[model samples]
Target: MVSTGLEDLEQSFSSQIRNGWNARPVFVPAEFAGMRGRLGVHDVVMTVERSTGRGFESITVASIQTDEGTGRGDAATSTAEAPHDRVSLTVIGLPELGSPLPIIGIDMIALKGTLSLVALDLAPTSTSFWDDVCEKRLFALAEDARDRLVIRKRPEFAHETFSRHAIIAAARPGCEEHAFAIARNFFTLATDVVAAAMGRVGDDPIEARNRNLAWRRSERQNRKEMNALARMFGEDRARTFIDAFLFA
Candidate 1:
């Protein structure tokens, strides 16, 4: 169970993302760096290709856990108390035409003792794909932590592709009700940001076509059933189902 004191830890994480947004360099410790180095190489390549409009053909997701003493041998032995708390959601975007985009990976790191979450890295399949997925997952995670957090969408050019990140932080704790209020705020904010990011791709004719084709070809009817249910139950009900699934 997460301690109630973790509210402060959550606030600190939010502040770090805000600072990183303002300054452009979010310094992650060596532990996170190692995880990125090992797991993110493919994501970097995919992001670059997608950003260039070269297209992506396929993608995959993987879960990894690395304890202090196991993977890195002697180097990891000394830092057992400061073990890296790393979890990653890697998305590999492949273009239908030309070569496949490099893998796009987003990482979330929690400092072991502090239990404070941090944005370790947002790397795309390609150098250019940086903008494609950078702030999407980070903001989503922040929203999960608190509802009142806000993310200002700002896109810039860096490392070849256009990139943008959302600055996220919690509102004042204020009262007992504030916890739920903050959580609601984050949910709304994250949903909006994610919608905007997906809109960036879905609005594209080619991407729409790819999605339609993929959906048609998929043998599992889960997507179709979900869509039908969404239409029948409306957005709120669909959301309730999703929330239950995510939290429960």
Candidate 2:
């Protein structure tokens, strides 16, 4: 009984990302909130990007289709029924803004107890994207192994998890700008989402603030695409804002 489609979602999201007026943080990058609990949505939502085959661009937030509660937990990726009670957030964006079809982007989703799905958007946005995608499989497998083990608190999990979380943290603000057409940064929306959700649920702010500090420090830099920007403004001046990816 799905009444909405990608066009509807895209138009809705593009206009107001994660940091929109009604979004978390009160102001910032593009992000999607359920909006007073699913933005008045009563049905399970599934939105797909029109131009990309990358699974990250699309989002499905609802209960797990099935339950894989028990597994080796060896970094193996298995899809089950979406977690019914837990919030699942997915942030998707192109490899570079305005890139054509076959979009390359990252998708980060959190499950009830752990990440049911996580991966870097490592494909080129072009007809030849498949070749890049093929090269990424092995890399992804290895990375997943580390991620799964890290989730379990195995060895070196702390450092890797920090690094991994940093990347995920970066995704939110990154996508915010991509969708809103602004200078981009990373992790702002992600942090704000968690903070808002915690505050909404009455989680301890001190504890949340403590964790956010580490997550904040874990933050790192990202792609600074500004060639077109340079053309708009003078090169010398635009270079100063190369890091500037968002406007509002």
Candidate 3:
């Protein structure tokens, strides 16, 4: 189903998150269901899925597809060949408070037939959370991509939130596959981290919660993202979506 390079990466990421993590589908609220018609853009689609599993407290995978009329449409569209300017996939995995696992965050964007952006990070949710092995693997994967792809400078807010080795790239003409490789490898490493966190404990819940709150606070400050959502879904719905789905 995923023959195109960008589509292949999106499908691979979704499949890995669902099957590799044994994450099941959960209910999406009715209000968030009929979003296609709400937005007048052609084939505007927004899908949000929230699930929780053994080692995770909450796992969210959402996507949006739309033409250039609306801003920041996620790649959750069903038909990749359809007339659309952008498609994006966002994944956020929050480990259980006791697991001591870093949060898994990925945002992939495909625009005008090219894989434009690939943002992947394993963000720590606690003051004292650190994994030397994981950091080494992340840095290695990120550096390889950096050498081959066009790295994008992160926003000021993201600097403190995302890991030092996070891969934020703007894949130029022939670098889509290279970008895909880094993302795939990072995802694989994320699964390995989840597996390792299964029986681990002793993380401070208070510290984790504080870090998560701070991350969300910083994320809310992204005017570009908020403005895009507001233009696409309206001010009220965009706010609600951000609170309920995006950063919740």
Candidate 4:
């Protein structure tokens, strides 16, 4: 297996989540761990990790890497001149049953030699949370990243799922470091949001839960991602994994 530099970045983000949240492993099926197999003419590797902490309901990170690489087919998502070899996706799900905090998400795709895309967001559950908890810090980070990188348009569902301050951008050859820093900064800010939500009162729990459910429904409707996963894995497995790890 070759390194697309995503491995290190994924490790860094996972470590931060573990330490900052005092997270403990959530049960994962054996098949989702250290899985190696063949997909078409290319060898494939994939992993899924899930954890839960005091204030968080669940946190999930998953990665998919293909030897021959794959194109996302959206130029806005990937400005790389070539296909990408690895993708790292993370979602830090807040406890929607209690707190109306935003869900933190980051997705990164790396070409064979360089980064192609980095999309980071604190997906808001309510307008008040967006304004009070996320607006200022998130926009500051987004603006800084935007100043250095080429901003990309979100997919249709993402436009509905992500907050206004979401940073969806492509980091060209020389801008990988800036993109990584922005991702890290967003993760840090997300942890701070979690800390602030501890013991903090929120709006109606029923409303918060319903909003999060709506967000997950929209996210799961992403056809491109679902189609790609179905192609590599079976449709049933893909759907199961999506429901279990990616959005659950």
The candidate that wins on lDDT is 4
Model 1 clashing-pair count = 35
Q: Tell me the tens digit of each residue's lDDT in model 3 across 1-248.
A: 11255456657766776788787767778777545523333556676777778577778777766544433256433334344433666788877654567878888776344666788888876535555437878888888888878888887888778878888887776657777777778888988887776676635877776776667777777776777668667888888877776677
Instruction: Choose 3 or 4, whichever is better by lDDT.
Output: 4
Clashes of 4: 0
TM-score of each: 0.26, 0.24, 0.82, 0.82
Model 4 whole-model lDDT (C-alpha atoms): 0.70
lDDT of each: 0.30, 0.27, 0.69, 0.70
> Looking at model 1, which ten-residue stretch has the lowest summed lDDT?
41-50
True-structure RMSD, every candidate: 18.7, 20.0, 4.8, 5.1
Q: Count the backbone clashes (under 3 Å) in each candidate.
A: 35, 23, 5, 0
**Residue 151 deviation, candidate 2, in Å?**
13
Tens digit of lDDT per residue, candidate 1, span 19-95?
42121222323322222222211111001101112233332222223233333444443322223332222222323
Query: Candidate 2 on 1-248: residue-level lDDT in tens?
Result: 00112123334443344335232222222221211112111112322222221222222221111122332344323321232322233333322222222222233333222342333322222323223322344244334344432223312322522322222222232232222221111223322322322212212334333433332222222222234224323455434422322210
Instruction: Report the number of backbone clashes for model 2.
Output: 23
Better of 1 and 4 by TM-score: 4
Lowest-sum lDDT 10-residue window in model 4 = 75-84
Give the per-residue lDDT digits (tens) of candidate 4, residues 22-54.
888888788766555444445566777888875
Error of 3 at 206 (Å): 2.8
